[model samples]
Target: MKALIVDDEQPVIVSVKLLVDWKKYGIDTILETTSAADVPALIRTEKPELVISDVQMPGLSGLQLIAMIHEIHPPAQIIMISGYSKYDYMRSALQQKCIDYILKPLDEDQLNAAVGKAIETYRVEASQALIEQSYDFLHSELSKKRAQRLFLLYHTSHQTSVIWAQLCEIMPAFSSMESCRIGILPTGHLPSELFSGARDLSLIVNFIHDLCYETGQSIASEEPIDRNIHILFHSELSNIPELCRRIVDAVREEFHLFLPLGLSPAAPFPVNFSDAVRQAEDAVQTCGLMYTRQPVCFSHVTGKEAETPPVFRMEEQLYTAVLNGHPSGIRIAVRLCLSDLTSGKGLTLRQLLLFRTAYIGLRMRWIESFRMNHKTAASLDAPPGSYFRLPFRDDGQYDLSVMEESLIADLSAISDYLKGVLGMGPASQNLFQQIEQYIHFHYAKHLSLESIAEEFSLSSNYLSRSFKKKTGSGITDYINNVRIQKAKELLENPEIKIFHIAAQVGYSDEKYFSRVFKKTVGMSPLQYRIAHTAILPPLDLM
Candidate 1:
């Protein structure tokens, strides 16, 4: 694609330029220098695929330049030009692997033919190099996948010695290391569909490798377990926080995503690797719930495991309200319980999540009591344990306002269900209308069948069957339809990006949103926007 010409005479360089249409030979850029000494430096920097040189120059001769070219860029195709027809020069040129030898007082046809031959040779070498590189890359990837599987097995299996031996066969460095620390880089709240494609996963793996290498750390092994990438590090524990910070910053700058890293304390190599892996996993779980932006360590969480009485007292008040069948009392109790959990000093997000889990267990016991006492009331199906799982922001941090609102809504729904069974609440038709209104209001938030059912104190099966029977649509379909409708309205504004619209409509993954939009509107989001709006400048799908 590029050619460099070296000659002592400026006129000779100009003649070569005018002799033939270099563009016809696929040489778009033509560089020239009168000094032979400058050729090697140019080759190193510019890396031109084709080289044309005069045999004799002021400083370094063409044969010497050819030797330097071979040492510097061996792939460069060379054509040697000489004024005299010297047999020794031709022999040396051939030894240096020059593609062609042209004589001075250059003939146009001969020069054109030589340039075409050089271009063809360059293409062939480049194609061959690409094939070899691809083969190497595939072999390297295959080895990495095998190592990842061994790592998973070693961490999970009781026989660590056997797996470590197998791992050292591929990664010999592990045999030399005495100890290592494990770190988990969680994808946080990013949708799993973002990594459903191998290209995306490979990009992430390469990006992480580059950043870690820059920080003077090499990943011994990296395995994707659940939503986190478990990385083995031979670096010191003190160096880990800074390395993690760099990795987090780089990922944020490059991928535009927040990646939280969690580290475990140093553990002895091979034997304690499983414990290290588990500690790293625990650290990530804590980091997922914490409000801080820094990386978390398993030790830090263990150091703050003190008891809090306020959470317990507030939970008791909530339990008492449910037992008394007081709907208003339940609302007040839910508020106070959440407020107490959040207001306490040094209370981590993990504590709040734990308290919620305990509260759900107690609530289930209360429901059983009601069933035993009110035998004449309609049969009440208990919601699944998963229905009460806390909702977190896309960044893997809790939003207290959203959490409080959701808790109130679901607990209030339970009160309504209990009252309805006792003939003290609204009719089924009115309740369904209220549910529809609630969905319309909170459509932008994370809404799921289980959470919605939990909010109304009704069983998931009961709500799913009843709602479809009345509205002729499933809850999930209704939710997606509502989101697509909002997305269409947002798409009309050309200023907003499609991904932003996806977030605004409660879809975290843009690609997933596009598919849903196409399924609902009979066209992709961009196509729909183009059809409805005036022509506008292009914007990224992300």
Candidate 2:
């Protein structure tokens, strides 16, 4: 480690240098510079692990120099030296993460202690960093191998023996294991409420590792693929079904939550890994659709026609009600449709989303037809890929109840938006009236379509359409009308100049105000004032 000492004053620098034993503190070289200006360049070249500087300098104060050095070398430890013993300076030094703040007229013992402390701290941190880096490299290599094993299993052009070689290196028991299988935790299998907002799979992975380690049933390696946890199991002693049952029981015991596990029929290693993965996925899909917590193995399930009887069929009443833009019956229709879909034995998220897309599309069209703000209306338009933006659990499981509730909310919003447009419903009408009243009162102030809409907490497009429908005039026209009416009252005064009258209203330009005056009132300000001014019948002196 290297240490750099910066001070404009020579005596203080020399005194400090003589006091500390740099070699004893593990500092191989001690670089001394009298100029604060040269500190940045030296920091780059020397790359010192420690910087000791005087707080008050000619060009750059110690605080400024420390900041500049930090930009060049963030990990370098800094110690502040100053003539002043003020608390503010000490507080500032602490805030900058300086290792030590030393006072001038320095103590030799204190200086040596601070130097020794900084060196020791760097040594410990460096050692710890090296250890962590090594661990991370190992974990990363293992994770890469796990991913490669899955890829080779699924894409299968590579020789299966190569995969076996890779697996055997990481997992010793896999060398003799005859069969293997992959299982997926399909969406909605685990209740979202259990994990809540956690997005990291580490907790669940750790639990699985602990369970497998304790039982000594099989060597389980977990890889998160497409937001689903796929656990690879290898065994020399235990059967696949027994292993699956142990996993499910362990989860239930730990979380007090039901976890539906699906296992592919164990296939002989290497050659049948791909088929096993597919089988496991299908089994998981079936378990998810049935909403069962038990482990469902493809090999164990026989007579599929008997276990899962088809229960879903489209109902015309719900479809027609949705088409007619009646939300009153949409809720019941949505519930019935969801129930029918979930009733089947094997339903996947993709299938469910595709079926719901048509109904949501119809609702979007219904919403688009209403006079709504462009932003809100655009939100109603579902992105080409997604149905709607809804929250899901950490494990990527969809909460059917939340999904259904969102659909209901969308239906209600569509109904409300339509009603407001057709009948100028009281709630919607009141908003328009409020906007108009705001314009009436603030006509003399600067106003624009966007600004007024913001004032009323509305979008410009929606407010403009609604205002035109209710008042029979556009927003700009209404503002000008209010200003013109006020201008006429001012014109009655006869003392205020036309330019002053224009300024009294919102218009700054007299020419523009006159053009508007003529356009609305059919006369110039001067002409209208003369025409309206009363003339007394010739004062009768006779």
Candidate 3:
């Protein structure tokens, strides 16, 4: 486990550093920083398990950092340390999901207790996950029988009494509910090494049972050989959205997997069970295809079937923006897609995640197309396609704000890569104009390949290759030509020393500058100046 301590005060950081012996609590690395602005990059690089952050700080407040950390690393625990005892600040920290709130004049005992509690929570969760993973090997014949009965109730048309009675016997939670909704959690592609062969189906079925059992929900319908697990819940719970979120979180945290859920609207029990199944099936198919973590609830669809726009329509527009290399176009494309998904009411967070899944495929394909078309791109040795996979992939949820941030970052990288590619081989008129203008303005100073590339937000290697391709000369050669051209104008003035002229042209050492001047002008700096001076009509002797 890793821990990060953040504070603006040096003494405060030092004090907190000594407040706890983190190694005893399973924290091997303790990363401390005084600036909150540095926290985001550190969070990405270190992936700390726990963060102790000050409330008021320069750049980002502790509460703000807490929110960022949660999105980037959902499992990481946070303890907010504030000098103020005001209720509003404490309330804000809690709202941000900080694990513990510590007031000014930190109490060693309170701090110790918080760290201990966090560690224990992590331990208990890990143990429960272990149990869930081991469930397939331990389930008995009775479990299999129960799963079979639920499957029969959902699939076959039967008397309401018969199905209700069987459901009550198998899972008593349904007996008292006036109405129930069924949801199907659809399995994704299983890992070959762990989920392969004859036992894979049984294991997946058992995994669903374990998930429901752990979440306090009852498994309603189960086809032992089928890949989807159907769940039953009382319709009366006003917080169905909360329940859905918990289910999604638990499955991901335990099994490191995501199963799209298709949920039915709450309907009268027994009579509506079959109808609920059909609704869930529709949702399942929709969500499974979209790769959303949220269960689709049929009751939420607002638009008429005729008005519903397909997700692929926006996806196509986004694909064009990526290929065209316009950052604003890509942003608009993603926003439109998200807007379409959310236009309907009762939209679960999981349904929103579908937007991510749908576009990720397009994003990866665009990257692949670029790599395949440009041999120069292949030589750059850019990161692999999998490098673009978001951290949310394993966490089984999407934080829209974080997703937006990720999209911008990815697009920036893609835009930069494309800018490099576009700069090569007959540059677009706009790009060529911009590069020339930039070079003309900043030719002075040590303008290396990397500095210019950084200015243009491109990879240095790619920029160098492309610039040579466009201007028919290398960047270094062009810079030298520009320097010599400037040196020629200065040589016409005898008042300026050769050394001063050399320094004025962005060169530090006159000797080296002289050598370049000779190579370009076919004469030494002094020889060129003297020759030009002789040709000039002798200065008026009046």
Candidate 4:
């Protein structure tokens, strides 16, 4: 912004100039005019966007100066400085839409504030002009097209052209890809929510560009279309499945939520641009619950829709059960859903999303019903307009559908993890299971670590890792927890002696048992028995 300081008092003109820290507001050049008559000439010649003029001036009053300046340079914003707290002068100045007024004895903050306001008003007007220009172009483009064609055009009519202008600025040179591979990655639902006030999505656009570039993809453009990014290339497409997998994995790693990366039904950037966009949209939509299990592209191990039997009708009942907090309903829904998978018609990533979306929505509803004080069905933290609400952003973690899919995928990972372990082979896994069942049935025996490890036909190290992985706890820890539980029951039976309880829980040595008991339960067995030794019904031996 160019600021013209106008005052008949030369001292006031210089003082105002020196008082302001114009550079802080991104303004630097400050012009001075001591005479009111000089104001119009200075404004016209300098074309300053802002004018700070003294209300009382020789010959032409500050109001007159502003009027003259306005007629010739309508864009210039005028602010009147007055010696008196006169409402009349202030009212006249404001009526003409002067930027602002500041009384004499100009404080530094006051001058800067006035200048800041004038500059802010000018910037807003300038931005409105850009938006208008973009809008006009779209309207003109629409005018040239037929009615039906108009409706099918890029819907983000406002942000598209603006982003296009930026795209031109960034990729001033590029026709299409011919060398390196390019993957036009798809995002969940950001494109649809762009026009809707969800969040600032510009970073998402750039992130895709940067990711592709860094991942050895010769991307050509960083254009934002609606909410989706057009991952153009200066080359071909390759390992799109692997790219999809990595992308999904990276997203899962960074964001707690999940979205399926689709192979975009088409590939290699020299493709039908519109089709690329359409398939990209499909890829995103494929992230919806019913299709979340099996991936169609590079995204990854998603639900296989073909394998997922059509249980859409039962979804409502399942969801209703969850929303009603009927655990039995949850169990049933889970079993039914799992049974559908048993058909071996594995679900596509999108189909799984459909189920998960229903599940998540139901879970949220159930939580809401318990928090009856709320009116809307959104989460309590996200009730209505809470700032810390669950995500609906196209790319952020914690999107309702994505979060559920991710957690399910993580748990599935645990199962997959177990299945891959060497100990989990049928012959081996069953042996461990048998040994574990035996231990539970015979915990009162004089069980020894060597005997247990030997029973499984495995070295202690392998058995230990296997047991810990399958049960998510070490065998020793589990045994202690179980033994302590049994000890508590025995301690309550006043008919039992502390020494006898120790012997029954597999320890023949009472003092050693006391030491282990204190380590496990923070008390000696005798003390523990004393604390909770009331007589009770005998526990079933089986």
Give the winner by TM-score. 1
Q: Provide the overall lDDT of each model, using Cα atoms, as 2-decimal numbers.
A: 0.71, 0.64, 0.66, 0.56
lDDT of 4 by residue, 1-542 (tens): 68888787888888887888888767767888776666667776889888888888888876777678879988777788888888988888898889888898888888888888888888888788899999997874343232212212322253244443443333433323322222344443433444233233444433444455454333322234433345443334455556556655664564433444444454443335455556655555445333335433433334445532334545544433323233454456545655554344333334544555554554454334334422332332332211112224444433444333433343333223223321223333455544554456457775656667765456888878888887787887767766766788888777777778887888788777777778988987666756775544244311
Error of 3 at 45 (Å): 56
Candidate with the greatest lDDT versus the true structure: 1
Q: For residues 1-542, write the lDDT of model 1, one tens digit per residue.
A: 78999999999999999997887887899999987767778999999999998988887877888888889998899998888898888988888788888898899999988888888989999999999999998977676666667766766576378887887776776667688888887652344555545426557766776554333334533454554666777744346777777777766666655556778888887678778878876776554345355544554443343365344577546544543445677678877876666563445545655666566666675555445435655355543232343445544445666666666666666665555654434444456655664566567889999988887779999999999998899999999998898899989998888889999999999899899889989999999989999876386755
lDDT of 1: 0.71
C-alpha lDDT of residue 122 in model 2 = 77
- The per-prediction tally of clashing pairs is 3, 0, 2, 50
Write down the TM-score of every candidate: 0.65, 0.40, 0.32, 0.28
Model 3 lDDT per residue over 137-206, tens place: 4564475456456545545556356655775665565568788888776543222344455335455556
Candidate number with the higher lDDT (2 or 3): 3
Better of 3 and 4 by lDDT: 3
Question: Is 3 or 4 the stronger prediction by TM-score?
Answer: 3
Name the weakest run of 10 consecutive residues (lDDT summed) in model 3.
Answer: 383-392
Which pairs clash in the backbone of model 3? Answer: 151-222, 294-350
Whose TM-score is higher: candidate 2's or candidate 3's? Answer: 2
Question: What is the full ranking by lDDT, best candidate first?
Answer: 1, 3, 2, 4
User: How do these models rank on TM-score, best leading?
Assistant: 1, 2, 3, 4
